[model samples]
Target: MRRTAAALGATIMLSACAWSNAGLPASADETTEDARDSDVILNMFQWSWTSVAEECGSTIGPAGFGYVQVSPPQEEIQGTEWWTSYQPVSYQIEGKMGTREEFAEMVQKCDEAGVGVIADAVINHTTGADTGAGTGTAGSSYALDDFPGIYGPEHFNDCREDISDYTDRDNVQNCRLSSLQDLATGSEEVQDTLAAYMNDLLDMGVEGFRIDAAKHMPAEDLAAIKSKLSDPDVYWVQEVIGAAGEPIQPSEYTGTGDVHEFDYGRQLKSAFGGSIAGLDSIAEGKLDSEDAGVFVDNHDTERNGETLNYKDGDTYTLANDFMLAYDYGRPSVYTGYTFEDFDAGAPGSTATEVGDASCGAEEWTCTQRLPEIQGMVAFHNAVAGTEVTDWWDDGDNNIAFGRGEKGFAALNNTEGEVTNTYRSSLPAGTYCNMAAGTDCTETVTVAEDGSFEAVVPAKGAVAIDVEHME
Candidate 1:
């Protein structure tokens, strides 16, 4: 299975579902096992460019996540608003977060610690709402019909400004989204510029890209630009929001890289909220397989309330734990600081320096860094390449299951604790419990009968491993 940095969402359930051309490789090869190792791909999302390196050190960095999904790295338009990063001034790596050199240093340091970096590439459009003569550090000019010749008007969709016509493929695919200036990606100049920008990052050591607003761009044009990138190791993940079924959908981008599986997040949250049944049901497993990327919340949907966010409270933890426990899409964990309004950015009111500038040590939820959270990473790594087997559930929200023979976990979100005995697949021994707070405050023991008794707390989850067992 190829590791990806893709979009996942809730609103996507409203659209028709689509499937990926490729599936998990039939047999687990060395590459498959390595990729499946949660210790390698356990990821966290960071706002500023250097936040990953500054906050998460080699300790959690190497043992858990291999990389980070950083906020957009390109030059963004200046505004008091936080959405400015969505508005690209140019393709230059320089931005409010950091300069090109600083970004290079950050990526190198993270790489030294055995963690990779995935940049959020926002190439769907340009800075101005229309377009105007503005120069990026790389000397790229912006021209639009609203302005003139800075970036030619022909570069735009030149159709209706408002794109309410979802039926019109051109308006949906080519036209500007959210009043952002649409770039004619098919143009040779534009393709070369994008390639140049990406190549710069490749030279600086970025391993992959999360193509922003991918659903809005012409797949062929995006493909051509991707083809020009220098690194074949550079993975591509397009943000094709909503369901798949349009003439231009996620499938178009799959041959190049994985597209976001938006429906998974919605279903996950619904399941955790008790609106849907637990994971063991064949119905629920089938529901999660529609796409490759699985996540509880992302930058956009977190603001929209259509998806689960940190502010949603403990509910997010339950859903996230379930996602890790169950086999599904490549999980993208959201790691951010506290926020008040829907439109908040990082931990700061203004976009200034990178690293610890935006959010302080107090606010950041370095998700994978937490012991309970890191336990999930360890569980995933221990059970790498194992299919979930020996599924057991009472059908009343309390459940227990094992992944192959490597690990077993249980969850009880009910009002009272659960003291049930079930087959633990794992060897007889004691293992540390993750959901029981830091330093493995709780423990689980498996007997020679392979039956373990777990007293699951109300509204909590527990995980145990064979290796950790005595």
Candidate 2:
């Protein structure tokens, strides 16, 4: 789903699967409902179950993140490579992430903190590597196409070679991706097997899923699998990488749930990398803001340098601040361990047993814990359903906007400080600058006419919501 190239080929198969009542409703109702509770999600990339549990109880829950997207928990190939999680070996809820007991405990603790856990479900395929046969992390052994109790050669796609023609929908869906084994999703037996695994997670109290490589499976086939799930109301966000003129469009998968808006991230990178003024044109883009799950960057893009990340310093924080301020898609912030090699797994052991995550540790990059980003999460939740009103810009690097009367934000992306008097939507009063933190040295006083003058620091931002009013 990350890399791309191909040509058209003969179509291989199609399904007559009917729509499922178990899937989420095809309306903005879910979006509106979710915003009312917690609008922001945190993708805690590659964190161990123990680490996730501790953070959920101590930080993530109190910070008001609606959900945490954890790494794939299924048993997978034993290796230190990060992509090993994508190459699942069995449905057992045990892998480098943690054991089944630890995973259940994490889910329970997160739920207690009012945070839902979104498991990264890797059901599209099994181990595709020709690394011979071996036992997985959970002690499940397998040969090339022979996963003992879970699957056999019959459950895999007939097209047993690497995908050569992305332009061909058949080749893209049925053929192996990057030499990984492709599953026969159209098979009812496979659907039942996948549903059993997902339902097991649901039984463990998981609220939703981030379906990995969803575009590799036919829409109808996915629908068939979803129809068998026990939980009818769980949330979903599909990883469908659709670009202009691509054979697979994100919209095709919307029937199941919201699609990860890769285009939105690209646009944010372009705007933040150049001038803040370019953001004014973002509203006119092709993506429907309501049904999109937006983010500044994800685990994949951050490593590939296609999007801005924590390493970009204040510029990265500013971009996320802008995202939270704007009433676009449902925003998500990412946190992960630091790495030099793109494919390197989490720091510590040989990637067999993940180490405990600690903010003070040299390997962790907890971007979500940054004061500015944390403040913006509250700003996003506080201004839900409010319209983007009173937009103002300097025709260059500075821009300020208000979310009706609920909140206001001014960003100075320029190299030098910017002092500007802008119309505000907030009530007249003294307010602490949330972006600066609770012990902030800066304060803004709005007059009865809803106007305030602010001196925003270069590469820094100031955000104030009704909740932060003094």
Candidate 3:
């Protein structure tokens, strides 16, 4: 580990210092209790100004999602294109998404609903376009060759013609991403400017940030900007996608916050399709142990045809059911309106002037509001502290497991009907059949032998507990 810099407190800029978690004593029982008590899973996949503000307070607020991940709130070059949001014109909060006041209202509303707001910080670069829309950016005008007094030519690396290899650490960290304008994060001026923009959002009651293009920035520099901000709860979940064996590792950002777990999506895709045994695989430690952020899909992967997002009907529900039933690193649910093209903006899409209600104009509800969805949420909350106790799998498609004594879940992916007998950890009583979708409620009566026989559908899953049992 690198020695702690003496000038760490001197300026708010990043210093080349490494954080070591070695010999940091284990957490106490009470501390774990407090952590479990306060932590709340969120579904903040949508990112427009009005949609974010309204959903932050109302839509996902009451669902007990602890955080709201808003879209990039910074001003971008004016264009009808959706990717324009990713191409930042300036650090200013005003954009087509919504105005500064609307952003504040969203944050306060989420806070009031016991949820935190996370801003998407795009400090990695600027608008890569040459002309026709680059104007009035953070009170400065910009051109292809002459970006006014605010940004200097030295602040940008002229790697336009000479593209650097992303496999190399320096090139990935220092060079431009996909011909986008690369900002010189190592420069003192750039650090201060970016830090001020982030701090402004923090002052508006935003809790943390999702550092976009985090893999393209150095950890030391990110730490420097993080040190400048004065919020104890300022969480950072960087977007560093990783597979089974990748050079660009997720462990690099474990000290910062949680890294996005791309493997989780792969696991869900495989397990739900019956390629991998559901409960047994999860029980036998197929999933990574370290706390990597888990999600079915996100904005980029969903659009790129890489991972399975929740735009579909029953397929999405099965995926989410497994996620809620099994324990994984901090879980995040995605809520979005159906889109015809990948580059399209969010539903009920409106510019910053119209406000959040516009998003609802295109809002479409699928399995997210299903009765089983609510049941899974309650089950996840109920078995928060427990670990997988009794595991059972037929080795092919049928599987079942219990989360200590709190709850039990089973899955059947076989073609025809198959009965499975498993130990019912819950006390003798009638339990609710969660997967039956309210049309038919099957009763699971726990026998004195401490076991229950569940006859599931031709191909389906089931979750039962003492509370909602008929």
If both were scored by TM-score, which would come out higher, candidate 1 or candidate 3? 1
In order of appearance, the predictions have TM-scores of: 0.84, 0.92, 0.81
Query: For residue 301, what is the lDDT in candidate 3?
Result: 72
lDDT of 2 at 28: 28
Candidate 1: residue 168 Cα off by (Å): 2.5
Candidate 2 per-residue lDDT, tens place, 146-189, comes to 88766788999999888887788999999988888889999998
* Alpha-carbon local distance difference test for all models: 0.63, 0.80, 0.62
**Model 1, 98-140: lDDT tens per residue?**
6667677788777667566778888878765653555432333
- The CA lDDT at 11 in model 3 is 24
Predicted structure with the largest TM-score when compared to the true one:
2
The model with the greatest lDDT is 2
RMSD of 1: 8.1
Indicate the residue-level lDDT of 462 in model 1. 84
| lDDT, candidate 3, 247-319, per-residue tens | 5676777666666777677667667665436544542333243445677777787778666766645566667
Q: Clashes per prediction?
A: 6, 2, 5
